[model samples]
Target: MSRSARAIAVNAALVLAAGLTLLPLAWMVSVSLMPTGEASRLPLRLLPSAPTLEHYRTLFTRLDVAGYAANSALLATAVTAISLVLNSMAGYAFAKLPFRGRDALFRTLLAALVIPAQVGMLPLFLMLKGMGLINTYAGVVIPGLASIFGIFLVRQYAQSIPDSLLDAARIDGAGELRIYRSFVLPACTPILTTLALFTFMGTWNDFLWPLIVLSDQDRFTLPVALANLLGEHAQDVELMMAGSVLTVAPMVVLFLALQRYYVAGVVSGSVKG
Candidate 1:
């Protein structure tokens, strides 16, 4: 093939792939506005014969998706906030602080990363149940409070900070917490934003743990609620699509906003490793 032909072919392939990937998402939105039974008709139509938001209304009013949305928001926010604090503390300590067995301890944790979190999930669930948090938001929040990967991400980024800066702070009588809050936090803003985005999205999209722990319908996160909605409203294609859209929209927006930082973190970590 000629060079231009090859380039044209590559561009065409990329456009095809993008369309393929977006097809389902596009269909979801289209069907969300479709009349109740139109999506499941004899022919697969790309659009509603007559578009409407009635299904969205049903989700918010009768189906009580608003509650599920609130639960999802609360859980995602809580997990992100808690993980930020814990991960930053552990990460900063690992990077800058001199302590007994620091390298060994971090090494142990690095090894622990090889262990699937699922391995400990059984015991963790039992522990949470014993504490009466099984059906509560706290149950969902506990396991994600500190992710090994989150800590490692922050640590790798923190290591880039000059030792002289920390030493200067120490000599100037700045306490560890002060240094962390004022200096480290500012310096780590990019990664912190990235991690917050990661944690929030993970928590929002989580299905298994939330499915296992939360038994109450009132406390169900959006994903769990959507699953439940699927059970009763298999016939309501428009409503299901609206629920899917709501469930996906926030995380997508967040990712687009912080994608640069997230991608940068990935590239930096790969190079460092």
Candidate 2:
């Protein structure tokens, strides 16, 4: 094939793939805007006969989706902020700070990642229950305050920081905390932003743990509340679609907004490695 023809072929394939990938999301938006009972009609329609916001209104007023959204936003934000600090400190220490058995300890932690998270869920629940954290935001947020993947990402990025810079800072009589605050944090901003976005999206989308921990309806996150809505409003397809849009829209917007940082972090880490 001619180079021009090959390029045209590749572009056509990409366009086709992109359209297929986005079809469901487009359908979702269409269905969400559909009038009540329109989505369940005999013929599957891509576009609503007449768009309406009744489903959205129903979600906010009747289904209390706004409250659930607020809960998700609060929990996800808190988890992201706290985890960034803890994970960054641990990752940077592993990368730069010297200590007895530090390599071995880090290796052990990496090995622990092979274990399924579900394996500890029961014990975690029992421990939280003992501490009276069940049915609370703390319970949902505690387990996610640090993750193995977050540490790994940060450590990879932190390894790129120059040891000479840290040594110079120390020679200048900078304390460990001062060095971290002044130099390390700024250097790690791209990776930290990536990690923060990851944490926020993961926490926002989490359903099983929140459902298990938070028995009260008032404390349900968007995902958990959406599941509950399915149980009570199974026939309300339009309303369900609206709720799904609300549940997913924030992460979409957030990723779009901060994707540059995320991409930069991944590329930097790959180059550093």
Candidate 3:
């Protein structure tokens, strides 16, 4: 139809979609503030009769959710930092540096992306056990250091960098590492921030791997701790919701903070590709 009509329709659709997406999160927050057993009552109320922080208090004081939050933050941050370095270096090499069979090797790794991650878990677990890394933060962080998608993102973005710029640096007798550190890294900031956000959110939400690696109660990340909370407090729906909120809040805050970089990276990569 008309231009203004189309614009109005699109805006309305976006608002509708936003509301639908936020409905569950709203319900989660509402349920978390609900008094115990109020959520289980008939008619399924969305708002609590009287909001209470009892569940939250119980979570922090009795359940020690702060410790789990700390563990998740530590592991996710470490994974994000390490993964950015490894992925960016490999991605830059794949994009800029020519090597015998470089394209072939990168393609092979891309092909590996089609395989399910779960398929490698058994072998990875065995390998980690052999190295005596189980029950350690290193065990959780090691597997996440390099991701095929992260490499692909950086490679695609790095390809947008002008070869002439790199050539000038090389002609100035700058070493490969110096060129990468001084120029390449700075140019890749948008994509690197995006990758950091991705890695952090993924690591923070990871449950199966961390649960398998860490057995100590104190070492459990928020997701694993929340799952444990479920096993023991299945009937305490409000308490579980509170834990979920705690687990998810950091990711929401982080995404909001880095959304500009994340969107810029995606747009840049899409245009460059």
Best by TM-score: 1
Ranking of candidates on lDDT, top first: 3, 2, 1
Measured on C-alpha atoms, candidate 2 has an lDDT of 0.91
For candidate 2, what is the total of clashing residue pairs? 0
Using lDDT, give the best candidate's number: 3
TM-score for candidate 3, residues paired by index:
0.90
Error of 2 at 239 (Å): 0.7
Per-model TM-score versus the true fold: 0.96, 0.94, 0.90
lDDT of 1 by residue, 37-80 (tens): 89888877898899899988988989888899899999999999
Q: Of 1 and 2, which scores higher on TM-score?
A: 1
Evaluation by lDDT, superior candidate among 1 and 3: 3
Q: Candidate 2 — worst ten consecutive residues by lDDT sum?
A: 264-273
**Off by more than 4 A, model 1:** 269-273
lDDT of 3 at 78: 97
Per residue, candidate 2 scores C-alpha lDDT tens digits across 1-273 of: 999999999999999999999998988899999999998898888899999999999889887888999999999999999999999999999999989999999889888987988899999999999999999999999999898778888888899999999999999999999999999999998889889888898899888899899999999999999999899898988989999999999989998999897677667546733
Question: Which scores greater on lDDT, model 2 or model 3?
Answer: 3
Question: Model 3: how far is 56 from its true place, Å?
Answer: 1.2
